[model samples]
Every structure is written in structure tokens, then in C-alpha cells.
Target: MENENKIKLFLVDDDALFLKSLEIEFMENADFTIETFATGELCIAQLSNNPDIIILDYQLDGIDQTAMNGIETLDKIKAFNPNIPVVMLSSQDKIEVAVNCMHHKAFDYVVKSETAFMRLQKIISAIFEYRKMKKELNWYMDRM
Candidate 1:
């Protein structure tokens, strides 16, 4: 169950250990209501739930080979709802892949490292702040 005020987040990854670690790290924060998915297709199925953000793994190996990769999944997500911010995560630091993700409208691309969790936290916080400011500005404009 999620509190009405908490930001909803969907994290999709095929690596169980990594997914669990991320879940644990984000769970420490009360501001987020996080949901984990083992596949991109599964995450896409839940898009109607309207998460504020999605953190998706770039490579969905260990699952079926037919499973959509991050870029394909991102395309589906954007088609479904372009407003949802998606953060693409990769263990490999490939410049081409990162650029492609950005070209496809990824909110950010984070390479998996010891500092990945910290970087993710910062990105999420910045997104929340930006959304808050946008909402506040919209409200003010509506009154004019």
C-alpha cells in the first residue's frame, strides 16, 4: 500500500540481487513507494498505475532472450506515456548506448558502479524538486 503523497517508482531489472539492493536502498526513503518488476514487459503491463518515474535496466539478460531491451522498452513506455520520466541503468559504460537512450528521451543514463545508488538518489531527488516547482508555477499561473 502506498501513501497518497508518496512518489510512485517502478524499478525493472533482470538481476535479482541488484534489484533487491536497489529496493532496499530506496525503501529507506519514506518519500517513495517503489515497485519492482523482473521484466520490461511486466513493467509495461503496469503502466496504467502511472508511476512518477521508472528506473529500467539496459540489458535484460537472465530472462528470456525475446524480452525487450531497455531501448525497446523505453520506446513502448514513451508511446504509452511520454510524461513519465525514465532512468536507464547499465552495467556497461557504452557511450553509444547512453546517447541512444538520451535520443529516445531517457531522463538520465546511470552506469552501475559503487556510486550508482547515490547517483540514482540524487537524480530522483532532482526530479521530485523539478516536478514540485513545475506544479507550483502552474498553480500560480492558473490564478492569474
Candidate 2:
């Protein structure tokens, strides 16, 4: 598939192994322009590239002691472009963390586990489908 036609994804995580694994899975399974970032700061810096979806890690301080956590990154991404879908990924299974991410306008939250890749795929599909529906509805509304 052409690069323009493929979905663009930003995968942000401090864990090198997990990040590589996720990247490989997406590359093997889907037509996606995938970019991996070891830090939220790098992801934020590339917001202008306009990724269709971002899977960000909740704890980004694994390498850097003072790096912005997932919530902060989510907020920044939202501030830059509220329409970009961001899925928060974390090892933490705490409800509060997920709730906090949702409260900050995250598209969704996925706990980092064996099923994370599958869950992310589903969520990404849903995001695109929802956007398509919204656009169609707007088009119909405009005709009326």
C-alpha cells in the first residue's frame, strides 16, 4: 500500500523491548507508517507530523527521572490537536489511572499485557470508523 493510504501510528514507550515488539507486530500485521518514540517528549515534538493514532505509555520516566508522564503528554497532545486519537498504554491496571486518562480526553486506555496489541488494533479501527460516520453525518446535515 502507498504510504499516504496507510494509517500512521506513533508508539511511545520507555521500555525498549516492548516498544520494538509492538512495532514489529504492527508492521507485520497492518499497513501502517509506524514511528517509535522512547519518550513522550519526542512524540510531542512530532505532533505536527499528524499521526492518526498514538499509543503512549503511562510511565515515561523509566529512562528520564523528570520526563512527563502519560497524562501530561496526553494533555499536550490534546492541546495541540484535540482530534488526534491517543490510546494510553500502561502496565498499571489501576482504575484511577485509566479514569484520569479518560478525564483528560484520551481516546482510550489499554493496560500493557499480552492482549495489548489486539486491543489497540480494535480501538484504532473503532476510531477510524467513528470518524468516518461523523464525517458522513456532517455531510448529510449540510445537505439539509
Best-matching candidate per TM-score: 2
Query: What's the lDDT of the predicted structure labeled candidate 1?
Result: 0.92
Taking all chains together, each candidate's TM-score versus the true structure is 0.91, 0.97
lDDT of 1 by residue, 17-114 (tens): 99999999888854688899989999999999999999999998668898999899999999999999999999989999899999999999999998
Candidates' C-alpha lDDT: 0.92, 0.94
Which 10 consecutive residues of model 1 have the lowest summed lDDT? 25-34
TM match of model 2 to true structure = 0.97
lDDT of 2 by residue, 1-144 (tens): 479999999999999999999999999999999999999999999999999999999999999989999889999999999989999999999999999999999989999999999999999899999999999999999999
Off by over 4 Å in 2: none
Candidate 1 residue 55 Cα shift, in angstroms, is 0.3
Q: Which whole-number lDDT from 0 to 100 does residue 4 have in model 2? A: 92
Quote the positional error of residue 51 for candidate 2 in Å. 0.6
